[model samples]
Target: MKTQIEQIKVKNFRLYRDLHITDLQRLNVFLGANGSGKTTFFKVFNFLSTCLKDNVTVAVNREGGFKELITRNSDPEKNFIEFEIKFRNFEQGEKSPLVTYHLKIGFNHGKVFIDKEVLKYRRGQRGKPWHFLDYSKGIGSAIKNEQDYDPKSKEIREDQPLGAEDILALKGLGQFERYKTIKSFRTLLEQWLVSNLQNEEMRKIGDVGADQQLSMSGNNLAQVASFIHEYHPDIFQTILTKMKQRVPGIDKVDIAINEAGQILLKFGDNSFTAPFISKYTSDGTIKMFAYLVLLHDPTPRPLLCIEEPENYLYPTLLRELAAELREYAVRGGQVFVSTHSPDFVDALQIEELFLVKKEQNQGCSHIFSAKKYDDGQISELYDNGCELGWLWQHDYFKGINP
Candidate 1:
């Protein structure tokens, strides 16, 4: 089954209180100045995936406990941090159906607990979505036989006294194959990655191995580069060709084994007869190459979150990077990028773009589509041959403009 989360609803979480983004395209670009909750938005996925790694308690603790995670002016009535994700799940030979997973977390004495968790989907073309996996305060039931049937009707449900509130029901049922939908959803969540790549790590010699996927810090960049070469030569060759095309005088990319049995990245330039090791490579070259190693993986992750991809690259390379991200989307992978580069935004469509900002009066920050502002004048800019990046660079999209 192929799945991608299409919508996010957050309440009392970080700077977001009662926020929802419904229309999510495969490729999403978040444009905002610093301290506008862009990285906080990315942390939403990070938090959920962390929940899968352990429990909500551990996940909450990892981020300095629940108080640090919840919004400062959090609603008094809403004691729990809530997150809801709507996903389009495409099962074998079936039209993709919208599946929603909701979680509410509460904290007590610095301990986090799952206040409420529900996973459901609409049974037919219309009606209330059926809750296949529903649990509250560590006790509830799940519809075992999740085959095509009326979940609204009284179907066979298995009573599962899930041990504790802190432990997620999705975590428990996901381990059993009998809970097919639960397992698939868990696997999908587990596949999500939030990338905060470190340039220094990419520059260093990495472990002598080929990771199935790139690490969050990209410490395995060399191994991933070597991996594609040894396992997927076609992908590696394509990356090399792109590297040469994007980076001037980059003719080849080699993966060499060090005396210590570690993997290193070596680049060849036409000017030099000998290839220069990664230590000598430009920062931009290594960053771009690492991105290729990630985006071109044979088993692409269902969801990817990258922060400021334009960090070390030249402005001209932003367009090429954006194109590759779109290609990843075209291949059915969902990518979310938070970038401040207008050059990168210039390559994105208005529908694929979002503006995030903080309002003093409201005392919160949130993300919104261009359609929500100036009666949809944002799209008109594109019609008038003015790209989103240009308008944003000129401070046009932040507020309504003539």
Candidate 2:
């Protein structure tokens, strides 16, 4: 609830070629066919997070280097992988002016570096916007007195020179608390959770200790479970209550550290006296429990990107899961989910649902709200007692085939 992305723009990044999406919701759901660029869309945040945490070079190399990261069949000479995000932090309690962060990654002669980066916000109701942080390649200038910045008076500025050309300016400047705008954006990037949960990873035993937040993959489910059970008993009990209601016969959930200093998750069934270890539990049970642990975390992450949560979960359970995701968003974390389940879509509001589709021949993806299709026919259909899932399956969302 502190800050949320309202608009995102990407240019020459994989399947997205000059795509601009606006008015993002807190609990946004993306629907698309396989290979229609739903996963690629989520990767945008992952790519930015990696760039901020490490460097531009590392982020590029992680995605198979520059050649593989850029858009396919595009001119390398003219195009650079660019991303721009606009959001409001709500730091002043009421609605605040939009903060814009723009980043450009360029490659030349086998070298990848940050071409440009800027973080700026409009001052007052008019005039030119104030640039809090601005850099190109390895050097630029940033406003030193951001709190008392006055465009009408002489502006105080500081020259910033990074150690490497491939480094993000925010990564360097954010380390200092004086750069409040840069630090806030950096913290937001660091707290984003782009979850692509692997059930197999959740089943494996993990190192001893507790993690306040869940990893992109739910590998440390046991440690997190242990942490919640030991500190936040009320939240843990709520998780158990929800699990029992959704998954029949799940009486209790607990965790233990083995003699080797590894944490193991356990489940109890009312029908049996002996508790079942996570390794012996059903896939649905482990997945559901992992989700519960993640949602019940004491400190919710700023943003959550989950792809296909309906996988390995009962169709009937998906609607409630959708509701839970919305509730988590209500608790101050914005969630982005990509799903193929209609039951999940049926639980969503019109503003929360968007359709992602690849353009014919162009081979690039475009995203827009479902409520905007065919002069609001989709909205009209939904208002007339038709569920979104049925409408989507029947090819009512335009350009999306059943």
Candidate 3:
């Protein structure tokens, strides 16, 4: 069964004081003007998903944390941010179970405390009582008495930690045996895997590690290409076959480790001969190869979030990339993309697209579903031969108070 994110809600985090999003489809495209908090929203979900993974928390704090991460001037004592995820279970009649996971921290009397932490599971829709794994309250005070005969004697006592019952409940899942499957699956999601793309310069090096998992910055393109060619030969051949259809004369892509242990991509002819260096290859050629390799690799389905995939590509290729993404969605993978390119947005349907805008005075952000608009409004513009981008800019989405 395919497991995919169904919804995400965040509160009191960054530029978002409160945000709720629903109707999550396989392919979600976030479209908005610059500085409208598109990247911030993406970071929220990424952080939420990766918090328990080692090094992710530190990376998130470096980006911004409790001091700089939360809303400004919000109650220092009461400020807390929460994240909730809903997952669709393909085995159970496509029923999606909503999981409300929360992490709350605050400062009190010059000390930082994790005020509340919980992972609650709800079988179905809203109003359903949730089954919880962890829950906590605040610290408690203890009374101290000493030296009953000595009136001047003084003694110190420590306070007990909060949520004893909840802690036992989670720990008891194994020994006491409660909700074993749900607890184990929740742990899996917390440790979800990530694979990234390589950078342009590293792709030129032709090093062994260059074929390593693509870094978030896509700095290891060469190594990734190398790894794909060496180990996953079938996947590599599939990508080459697809790319050949688009770019003529591209017979095969090969990656070789040189005398200095550097990785190199060799583009051969129809007859397939010596591995020519890839540095001489054009930027479009490199980018296309990277996309093909990433898409064809049969790794576990993850939340593939990409930024500005249309960058450094010809207009014709942008349409091709969009079509590829749609095919990816149909294959049961979840994709979230943020783009300013009109060609990218026009390639998707109104239902598959979302327009993000910031609300004034509130300093909060919201997403507008383009599909909610009447069909007549969409058809009228389509019949007039208006492109999706032009309609959004001039007719349907312009001049509405955010």
Model number with the top lDDT: 2
TM-score pick, better of 1 and 3? 1
The 10 consecutive residues of candidate 3 with the worst lDDT sum are 142-151
What lDDT score belongs to each candidate, Candidate 1 first?
0.84, 0.88, 0.61
Question: Which stretches of candidate 3 lie above 4 Å from their native place?
Answer: 55-60, 91-93, 109-113, 123-132, 137-206, 209-213, 268-276, 373-387, 399-402
Cα-based TM-score, every candidate? 0.95, 0.97, 0.77
161-180: candidate 3 lDDT, tens digit per residue: 54432132222232322343
> Of the candidates shown, which would achieve the greatest TM-score relative to the real structure?
2
Candidate 1 TM-score versus the reference: 0.95
Candidate 1 vs candidate 3: the lDDT winner is 1
* Ranked candidates (TM-score, high to low): 2, 1, 3
**On a 0 to 100 scale, what is the lDDT of residue 295 in model 3?**
62
The better candidate by lDDT, 1 or 2, is 2
Query: Lowest lDDT 10-mer window, candidate 1?
Result: 393-402
Better of 1 and 2 by TM-score: 2
lDDT of 3 at 340: 77
